[model samples]
Target: MEISGYIALAVMGITLGLVGAGGSILTIPILVYLLQVPITLATSYSLVVVGSTAFIGLLRYRDHILFRKAILFLIPSALGVFAARRFIVPTLSNILGHLLLGQVLVILLIIFMGIAGYFMIKRPILDIQNHSHKKQNIKKSKVVLIGLALGIIMGLLGAGGGFLIIPTLVLLMHFAMREAVATSLFIIAINSFIGFVTNQSQFIASDWGNLKKYLTPSLLGMLIGLYIVKFINGEILKKSFGYFIWVVGIAILTKEFIL
Candidate 1:
């Protein structure tokens, strides 16, 4: 089971490296189900794995990143993540029954997975070629709202929320797909690490040795993905991964309710 979890982590890293999103989405479930980690502990583990792997990937795409846009989106997002991890998560954990909290978190994760799968599979049609027009239409307010929303989702789920970030960059910030993907990694790495660092209870509880074992293969796989991404069409890869996400989500749902 532990071996399987490690392999899954590698795949998650590869996915994140390939498209700059969707990788962290796999982290919590892999920890909880495959490694049999407790849900709350799994979330902390997820932040470490996802944040580290994403930072590595970001380095590979550093030249493509737009720092200004990354910062603009990051400020509110980081605040949101910190607040959620520090206050919201503990409050809810205490208020809810153990079984109920687990159920609620699982249900929310699955719902978010479904939403991410939908966005990946259904590529939005935009007049992205008209760069100036799109830039003119950019709404700074919406960007902040989206960033805050993404951060809340990340803090709660321990997922990087990259699925939403890429779209926001592309559609609102007028970033080309490559640039959006690169920038997404930057935001994810920063926000995830911030959330993890601020949540001292969870961070202190995490097992560094165990995390290192899980992280090794993931980092290697990320390197492989970075090499292959140059040859593959991202759109095609994203759609295929989206279908895979739906399948995994359905399987998880079945296990949770039926099995």
Candidate 2:
């Protein structure tokens, strides 16, 4: 089981390397179930793993990162993620019964998985000629709002909000797909890092070595995945992965609410 867990963590990194966003979706589940971590700690642990891998990925695209946009997007998300991890999660855990909140969060994660899967399957229509218009049409307010929301979700779940962030950058900020992806990776890395570092548990000195144990192999997998992407078709892998996410989401729902 432990070896299998390591393999799963690597697979999570490969997915991230292949697709960029879905790995966070798998992080918490991997930590909670495969690594046998508690839900509360698992979420925090996930941030470390996801953030580290993302930062590594970001290093490759360092030249492509939009500093202006990344910083603007980070302001709200950073604060929100910190606040959620510091104050909100513990409160929620206290207020809701263990079965209730875990069940509810699992349900929400499933819904997000389905939405992510759908978008992965349905590639958006792109107009190469309208690139300039797409770049100029973004609403700063929408960007800020979404940034705040994404931060909170990331903090609470310890999952990168890449699925949502990528679309927001493309649709709202008028960024090209490549730019949007690079920028989103930057945003996610900063957001997760801030949330992980400022966590309340740090004051109490929680066991972060556990996170490193899971993170090390995932990073190795990410590097291998990066190499594999040289030959693989990302679009095809993305869609197939989406279907896999859909199935996993349904399976989680079924396990929680059904049999």
Candidate 3:
């Protein structure tokens, strides 16, 4: 609504465009710390904004995506979302009030992002041509198992799982970085959409008005971010982005733990 809000929205959009997966990590913190939105409402708003932005990016880059490979991953991933949303999340939310649960969720997300970041930085270089050999060696069961695990994390945390998904696709399944990124977007979109729907009733009943105020600014930022993606070196920026997430996570945890 104000110039500061517009600036924040632009910053978030640029972050998403620069690094595809970390937009919500930035969005949530901006909403909570800067805008003074409650953690529960911020998380809900982050999901809708991030999901819509990801959907737009996916559409713009649809031709670059590997559809067949994405489907292979999405089927089990969707089932995992259903299980987590219908069974796991509701059970957790009932036991933990939304605000407390959001704090707990952010803690877990920090841990998850830390691990993903470590692997992204330390992973060994592989020859893409030899990937077929690696793929043949991976059992189908293991892939599904990993997919289910990632799906549950994505559903529970409201993350697109790009941090986890990209590495898994590349190292475990032997996809190239470009393909992995494209596939990761698809998986994130599917998982995020399902996660948002699962929590929609609560969001609708609470702060839908404030949520709507964020949509246009978020979408504008996302478009700018996507355009930047065309010119940027994503790999070089990932570690820096990870550090940014680490800082935000610590600040959020401290805020929740203290005042």
Candidate 4:
């Protein structure tokens, strides 16, 4: 792997530590474009990288995790991820003529990176404070649908879905910001790992040696991020990273579609 790849991985971990939700978004592109991993394999690698990092990132906010909520969310999510990886990805691979499945996945990933970038830059604060009491009363069906949708997205794009999950937890679930971020990590970890494990062939075939190269720096960055969070202004950092995501997304778009 190039030195740039290692630096990106560390930055990814640091982003996760700082924001708790957006860092793992960079994993796929980094693996594919920088580290020269095959795109399909990159998705699987993303699951490991994001899932493991998220699992580690959540340790700091363990007290804020809502296990019951995480469990409830996991059921549909796990099934959705399993379905996407086990069926949808393969089906798309075989059926899509001319357009490679890897290309399709990269396009989807770019679109999502744009969305994630928007969320990070805008950083809108939903006024759900008045709805605190009703948070628990949110319909179960809604949760299932949301979970299923997010799971499919995660499975398809190899993203942790933190950008989507955090907002869903905060606005719809009415969780506190701290709780939402923490629980987002928990959900991301399970969803990502479920996607990872579902692709058994990829799991077995993956280049573990290469994968470890990316993981080491990211984990170290996560620790650095945890410590840095205390000193930095989170909003400013988030906005800065959000713009960076857009720049990366544009570069991806150019590489994949235009150039």
Most accurate candidate by TM-score: 1
As for model 1, its CA RMSD to the true structure in angstroms is 2.1
Which candidate's lDDT is highest? 1
lDDT of 1 by residue, 174-238 (tens): 78877888888899889878987887454443487778888898898898889888898988998
Pick the winner on TM-score between candidates 1 and 3.
1
lDDT of 2 at 90: 71
Over 1-259, each residue of candidate 2 has an lDDT whose tens digit, in order, gives: 7778889999988888877777678877777666777667777788888888888887777788788867767898888898898888778879996767777677677877888788777765245325535546566877888889889888988888888888777677667777777787888888888888777345343465566688888998888877787788888888888898888888777877899
Task: Flag the better candidate by lDDT, 2 or 4.
Answer: 4
Candidate 4 lDDT: 0.83
Q: After superposition, how far is residue 93 of candidate 1 from its true place, in Å?
A: 1.0
Worst 10 residues of 1 by lDDT: 123-132
Clashing pairs in 3: 13-221, 17-225
Candidate 3 lDDT, tens digit per residue, 52-88?
7777767765666777766666778777876777787
Every model's TM-score: 0.93, 0.91, 0.82, 0.92
Model 3 gets an lDDT of 0.69
What residue runs in model 3 are displaced by over 4 Å at the alpha carbon?
Answer: 1-6, 119-136
Among residues 3 or more apart in sequence or in different chains, the pairs in candidate 1 whose N, CA or C atoms overlap within 3 Å are none
The model with the greater lDDT, 1 or 2, is: 1
Per-residue error at 235 for model 4, in Å? 0.9
Candidate 2: minimum summed lDDT over ten consecutive residues — where?
A: 124-133
lDDT of 4 by residue, 1-259 (tens): 5889989999999999998877888998888888898888888888888888888889989999988876667788888888999999889988984258888888888889998988888745454345454445677788789889889888987889898888777766777889988999888888887887787565542478777877898889888898889999888888888899989999999987898
